[model samples]
Target: MVPTMMLVADSSRDAHRREALCDLADAVARRGEAPVVSSFGTSDELESAVASVDGPLVVVPAFLAGSDRVSAELLAGLDLDQRFDACATPPLGAVPSIVGSLARRLGQAGWRPGDGVVLAADGAFDQDERQQLTSVARMLSRRVQSPVQVGYLDAWAPSVGDAVERLRRRGQRRVCVASWQLVDGAGHERLRELDATAVTAPLWPAGVVVDTLLSQHRAATARLAA
Candidate 1:
């Protein structure tokens, strides 16, 4: 039997931010028939939700970086015996399809072929997670056939202001910021302070995101079935 997917996210206290996540998950679940679940302040809640779900479970993390405690807890608490099939898909930002989504959004925001682009991500505390952001920036760079700089909001170096300044120093008059964030909240508020040509919206509500989530779910299911 095909396992049903359960998307797990780190809970946010911001009501609007939390609602946006739920809405995005609901949109994706509708396309893939997966149920959405979030880790609210503890791993116990996530584990309980997983236990309550019937049939084989396919867990998908609704985060951009994988080294966080929430991702760790979801992976650690799982017992992949006969019931739970797969867990630990790559984070949403690292997914390749997201590059296209970002590219289109940037273009819509007046990004030209010669304009510089900054891949702006909500900073991660983990070094590995920060490295993943760099990797995503590189991938996006290749996709658009233009140079892309990696910028963080906090907890890391080369902040949004710094990236934009660097791009300006490099003679770029228009620098587009591709938000590597999933939803708008305090993290995004920092991006507004950056003096960029234009800043694209977060990844939420994008069709490509839904496709990427489904692809991750399918790959996990295939791995378990094999």
Candidate 2:
């Protein structure tokens, strides 16, 4: 039997977050019409969401690369040891494979290696999650090979504007504002003030990022099932 799976996200904002939520639900629903749950506000909602299910439960955490504790908090509210056998796919925003994926997407979108890029994310205040996001930034920066900086749409040290100004000061002619926002939330509009040369869009470089995320989710959910 298919284990009951809960695809958890930080509410449905818009692009990828929206994509992830829809994909996970569809994946589970297609499997056998399993329960696909979401927690929008706090981690607490996850409890009620998960409680609605029976049998083995799988929690598919929704996060992009450079992720913060947003997912962690949502997961923490879950009783992993007893309530369900869980496997967490890290925030897609932080994975190196994701960077490669994002790079490929940008390449298709006329973004070259030296295009000054700001990998903007909606991060968290938790120290560990922040560290994880920082680690992801480090890994992705290597792939960028030019000037790739990390900034936040909400939390963290440097805001997006700060990152953009610094990069501009450093003589970056064309900057691509790649958002880690997967949801179609209001967060995407935050990039409106670019200096005409800055290309603003989702962090996705191409379709491959979405494909890889799905593959990884399946692999992880399978591992948890075992």
Candidate 3:
């Protein structure tokens, strides 16, 4: 039997968000060849799941950017050498699929060629992760053929509202917000107050996203097998 592949997602107290992520994991499991599916927001949950699953397992982080505190906890709990077959894959944001999805979502949100855009990410306090978000924003700028500014939901400078206002000050009335989130959460709730012409939905259930995840699983399996 092939080693099972599981994804660890950011856990939420919100029942709706939890259900949605589980649904997405199920959907991915169905679409791909990954045998097992599990998500853990906390280290305790992660340890329990790892103990329950036998044999080799490939753990994939469903996060977009740099690792968060929860992810750190999960990592700290894992003794990879003890379970030599198990390995963690990079975050989903490291792939190009997100960029493709962002462009498509922006188009669907009525974005025009010249429309000013803001890539709103769940900002990280760490400088490296913050740079990662900025890099993605620049990639988006190239894809959209417009200046795509970066906005944070938590820390760092330039909130989404500030980005929209800056664009408006430049006389760009039509501004669209591309949400760089996997699922709607409290951060998304705050996006409601942002003054923008349109805000795209979170990236989920997209063909590109599923394909990217499947590819990550394949890579992990291959690496572990090697």
Candidate 4:
């Protein structure tokens, strides 16, 4: 039997975040794939779905980075009836196409030649996740032909507002925040609250997001088949 595709995300009360996940699941389903969306906080629902599935499961972490921890935590949080064949794909942030998506959002936000760019992320406490975000900023810098600074929304130094202010102090007339979130939420709202000249939308509804998820799902499916 074909493995069910489960897209799991961190718990969030933001309505936009929930809607975006549903939209992503719908998009995947429209492609003739069986996709299910769940969150870590909803353990009962998640366990119910897992129990209902008959075959192997391809678990896709619906996060930009640090998905391995998310996946591990999710499994640990739930008490399943039995052990089932399951595999998780890489996080969305690890996909190379994400850099292009970020660059596109910057262009859409009216970024100019001398505009200072700050890649704003929902801070990760894990050192490896922090490094991954920094790498994303560097990749974005190269893609946009500008130096990109990394900033965190929480639990890290150099907040988004601070990054923007530093650029302002350096004589930059416009400072654009390239949101590094997968969906709009408290973090995106915090970014907009910052004093930056412009804040780009989160990387959702972008073709790359769906494409990357599908690519990961297909790869996991192939691995399971083997």
Candidate 5:
């Protein structure tokens, strides 16, 4: 029997968050896969979904940060049935195609060749997670042909405002903030408050997001089969 693909998303009050997850799930469904969406907002919601499923299960962490801790935290208290095989794939942030989508968003936001760029995200407390975010900024730098600095909305250092200010002090007349968030929420609101030339949209509903989720599902399914 085919395994059920479960996409576990971060909890957010933002309505776009639900739409984004549904869009991704729908995209997967269109590909003839069984896609189930759940959230970490409530343990019961996630647990119930798992209980309803039979056979193998593939859990995809839908976080843009791709932090393993986030995945672990989501599943920490869940009671997995011994009869069902279950496994999880890496978070969506690890998908390399995301850089390309970010570059396109930057361009759409009127980014110029020499404009300073800051990749703004909801900062992670974990050191390794921070490094992973920095790596994403480096990849984005190469794609946009500009120096991309990492900025945090919360949790870690160089705050979004500070990153923008640093770029301004460096004589960059225009600074653009590329949002590293998956959906519109507090992080995006924080980015808007920054003194920058422009703030690009979040990654929700992007084709890359759909593709990344599906790819992760396929990889997990293959691993389970082996």
Candidate 6:
């Protein structure tokens, strides 16, 4: 059997967080796959458990929910020279699962073709990342008929508040703030602080879209196995 490393940032305490992680793992495992979920957090006591597994190590600092402390520490711990002994998958970018997630949320909330949405991502200080996030938003907007805007917080352009203001000014009252961040990352925290009255919070689809994303993992793992 070939050894493979898998990593997940299980950052939050919510059942959704745990379920999302487990669902991905179970899906992968059911396909005869085993991966090490490299975790970093002081809360759940799961990080230490994951680290002890004697296999190839792939670090997945939970980028789902914004990990301020983990990010700072992660930056210090990172290496560009393929320094880790195992292959760590590039963290989830804006993927197809995102679109499915959005559709589910918007549909449940009675979103129509013209409803406004903003897929909020972690605003990166790096200009390239900011552009990448913008592209993701654009792509998603096209995928769904509803208008989707890009929202950010610190360190990026088109800040969430600004995105909201722009859309509101444009006469979009039924706006959905769909968070594109993995799940528990800073984006979620920022998302939580938004005015629900102006922007619908039904856009938090982290819990809702886990199964669809799990299928993505299964497909990737199957491809690897083949």
In the order shown, the candidates' Cα RMSDs to the true structure are: 3.0, 3.9, 2.2, 2.9, 2.6, 5.2
After TM-score superposition, the amount by which residue 192's alpha carbon in candidate 4 deviates from its true location, in angstroms, is 1.2
lDDT string for model 3 (121-220, tens) is 7666356566777778888888888999887665556878888889999999899998887766666677767778988877886867777878888888
- Which sections of candidate 5 miss by over 4 Å? 66-72, 75-84
TM-score between model 2 and native: 0.74
- lDDT, candidate 3, residue 39? 68
Q: Give the Å error, residue 220, model 1.
A: 1.0
Q: Candidate 6: what lDDT?
A: 0.52
TM-score pick, better of 1 and 3: 3
Model 6 is weakest, by summed lDDT over 10 consecutive residues, at 196-205
Which of the two, 1 or 5, has more TM-score? 5
Give one digit per residue, the lDDT tens place, for model 2 in 148-190.
6877876665887788878878888777766665444456666
Model 4 misplaced stretches (Cα beyond 4 Å): 34-37, 66-84
lDDT of 4: 0.75
lDDT (10s digit) by residue, model 4, range 117-140? 998876764666777887888888
How far residue 35's Cα lies from its native spot in candidate 6, in Å, is 3.5
For model 5, what is the alpha-carbon lDDT of residue 90? 54
lDDT measured at residue 90 in model 3 versus the true structure, 0 to 100: 62
Q: Mind giving the per-residue lDDT tens digits that candidate 6 earns over 91-195?
A: 444556655665566566556677678766655534444555666676677777666777766555688777877888899876777765544433466677875
Deviation (Å) of 82 in candidate 3: 2.4
- C-alpha local distance difference test of each model: 0.72, 0.60, 0.75, 0.75, 0.74, 0.52
Question: What is the lDDT for 27 in model 6?
Answer: 48
Point out where model 1 deviates above 4 Å.
Answer: 32-41, 66-86, 124-128
lDDT of 1 by residue, 27-138 (tens): 8767745555544334666778777877666777766672234444455566656554445565665667777787788888788898989888766646667677778888
